[model samples]
Target: MADWQGVSEFVAVAETASFTKAAQRLGTSTAHVSRQVSLLEDRLDTRLLFRTTRRVSLTDEGDTYFQHCRLLLDGLREAESALTQLKESPRGQIKLTAPVTYGEQMIMPIILDFMIQYPDVEIDVDLTNNQLDLIDSGCDFAIRLGRLANSSLVCKRLATRKLIVCGSPTYLATNGTPHTLSELGQHNCLRGQHDYWRFREDGRERNIRISGSLRCNSGIALLDAAKQGSGLIQLPDYYLQTALDEGSVVRVLNNYQDLEEGIWALFPHRRLQPLRVKMLVAFLTDALTNKVL
Candidate 1:
């Protein structure tokens, strides 16, 4: 009650300098305003005002007390203002992670555009194949190609990416095109197919364990191998789209191609999400959906 009534009395009397005027301003009677001010003075155990027939003057202690009251009210107003600004405009650092290959091939261009548009946000981009712990690692968001494995984190799918079983023109011309998946064993293969090659086998699904001359964990390396005619490699559309379009590589098994892999932006639940995280997720979503990259 002191915190509440004291503030009103101080503002009223200070602004009007007359209890009657202050009471009128506060929509209360003059006697009630005088009693509230007396209660405030008693709480502080100090005489705050001296009244004459014509005027009321603040005591020395009252002058100091009023200054502090002004400061407290100003601080509260400033805090509220800052919070309102934060809700309307975003600014801060955001931690983001993504697979190296997909980040470079797809997410990078979008990130570049997002940065340009939102100069206030600083992005900490970590590109790796390993699934990082969002809570422990302090990452705000993650961009994944294919399906996400973490159930705790929520994901929004951006776009479908087609996986292509392709080889360089030189390799196909040299080793000859295999009309059937069975003939794939006959030619040298550079694998990125993620251990299991998805093909329409026996009118159902087939996950074939595959091997290659140069087995690498890096998508770029496998793409390089396929480009140099090292072997036939399987890659998603993001990495091989330009190569396929330029005739650097030719798609094999068009009928056997499977469409399942998708690009996704993942984040934890909303309650604990920071301002920066929300801004980045929105930034990435628009950038990816609109293909601003």
Candidate 2:
């Protein structure tokens, strides 16, 4: 307590540039404030301020110390505020957006469970493939999959999903498995929204353009095509996991598979997020990390 005795008073004096004003703001006597500040400078063995009859100014060392102390003080205040918020139930609406299929398959279920637990909280979910501006659309946060583009939004990684390139066992038996990246040319490769598939070759990333008899934007439809032995299909693990486990589809080019993509919750920069938003983000993080969603 002795070490901390005059720090607040000194900071107040530095900010107000008046011992009397600092005392007034702190609800303490001017002589007490001056005495504390004097004791602080004596303890630190440095002159922190240049006192004048009309005004006060900080020394060079004092200015640097003040900057660090200001940050510490802010962190302390935020901690107190967070504690206060924790004592109250999170009651408000959380507006969020995510990719259409993932939102339906993974995120929505967890959100529904959260809503059940917190009856006072309301959620507005917008599922779309298009990347909407969170600030413009008035969303608190968004769920993004795959490789994210460089942006100013703050991100929290929730999980990761692998992209798999697979074909039905019957198709591979007849068409022959691809042994090398170049062999992909001779084989029919199913295309989704993009005509290319991402891969990592020899420690570098590559996008290989492919073509086949069928082209569809729906992952479910493409998974069906691969099941019926239409051709090779590349999709996320969520779509191909069940088929792969059931032996209906066989993964190929494991060595060339791209690194697992991130599952992230992104938010616009704000000084302090509301308790509800923080709670929802925490809930989603735990659920996704545990694979409960």
Candidate 3:
């Protein structure tokens, strides 16, 4: 009989090159991971790792063993996922990431609802504006907005969002509305993380470098500033929707508004996604497409 006792521990250590990180990934103590890897090496009668105070590295034999072990472990996970699908219930921990504001405003509600629907499922969500490397973070997927850089990850467009440039009526009255693309240079354009605003000119996408007194990363703060007649603002439709409807702000430069950009779900390349991930993606697609967001 093949004893599979420390294979996972050894693989984790090899992949992370740190017993501490492996232990963190496995939800165990560093001592336990070290002991398991030591036992694994004893059972195989081979040294698989070179450990120094600064770093850990795999031996040539360990590298060969890891290639096979990684594939085997992947197969094992797929088998378990397949079996779970047979039960007709998605159950497992799903780790994902999304933009902070949008995740809080839109994704979090849907996620909470999903949790209610599937009590067996677990979720760990990281909300940030920065694009995290899904593989390094061990996240199953990411929710990304606007233009995506070319990458090997699989992308599914869940929805589309229009960028609206608008300001409070008072601001428009005081500073004058920008009727042409060039006129935008004359007004105070509230800035976000980027110094540029996107538009469509002559049926082509254009980015205009904008400057303003306030430069903030928070959409809500910029929205408030616009409502208070601080300056013109460009933001996603969701952020400006309520204000636009309530007469707190009005759209300007409509002729130059950019076409809607995609809200995408990005996942690492894999032959088969776990059922839970598929379900969550489906749920998000439905919600966003139905204009629930």
Candidate 4:
């Protein structure tokens, strides 16, 4: 078996570009570091480094080996960190972002409860409609809704939100409810954010272009207009739940409402996440499991 100590010494020398500096960093003698690297090269039957009187440099094979060795060392350190964190309580500030409406109505309450449970934890949340990059924004995690675009970030589904089409009883009584996709085109539709509405027809997904006298980007405004008998509006269950319960708006196209969007907690791609982040995700998953909205 290869000597792990020798491999570590070789990596230190390769990174510092000098055995003397590597020794200084490792708190060992220069000769000892050089000998270890030499032993490492001998074990592999390859010359890993080229040395001159002034400085040291890696050979072609040495460069490739250094890359892999660096990653291996980093992973080892991360594993050790994870183990240490396992023994400690989940305590740290977690910076996260989420969409405005869902964050206010759904996530904020859960987060409040979470803070109460983990007294040592601090949470900083940004509630905005705009999607922010997790790494660039310095957020530990983010809550995202709807279909996510392909990306390198890791995602965990916390819950599901059903899309519902609804209108006020007064409007439905006068204009009639749409039973099929074709009938939807004849009535005024309140568009929100998207130009087309999503539905499922015969097990196939459909995006129908909708038009109306009022087109708004805010879901709350669209819902309000729909409640006042202005036009039919389609929205996620979180936005329409109270209205549905109060009989302010009645759901339409129940048979065709097929698209169910996921509420996801997104984090950076890493082999091991911080324990605090993991704990928060688990807490959210448990809190939201089987939730209707």
The TM-score of predicted model 3 comes to 0.75
Ranking of all predicted structures according to TM-score, beginning with the best and ending with the worst: 3, 4, 2, 1
What lDDT tens digits, residue by residue, belong to model 4 across residues 1-293? 35576877887788667888778867899999989988888888999999999989999999999888878877987988778696658887899999998899888888998989898999999999888977556788899998999987888898888889999999999999889989888899999778889999889999999889899988999999999999999888888889999999999999998767888998865335678778888888887764465
lDDT of candidate 2 over 217-271, digit per residue (tens) = 9999999999999899989887776788799999999999888888999996532
Q: Per-model C-alpha lDDT, please?
A: 0.74, 0.86, 0.89, 0.86
Better of 3 and 4 by lDDT: 3
Give candidate 2's whole-model lDDT: 0.86
- The weakest ten consecutive residues by lDDT in model 3 span 268-277
Instruction: List the candidate 2 regions with Cα displacement exceeding 4 Å.
Output: 1-84
Candidate 4 — which pairs collide? none
TM-score of each: 0.64, 0.70, 0.75, 0.75
User: Which has the greatest lDDT?
Assistant: 3
Model 1 alpha-carbon drift over 4 Å, by segment: 1-88, 193-195, 201-203, 270-279, 289-293
Question: Which residue pairs of candidate 3 clash?
Answer: none
lDDT of 2 at 160: 85
What lDDT tens digits, residue by residue, belong to model 3 across residues 178-280?
8998998898999998999999999998999999999998899999999999999999987976888899999999999898889999997532578988999
Question: Model 4: residues >4 Å from true position, as ranges?
Answer: 1-74
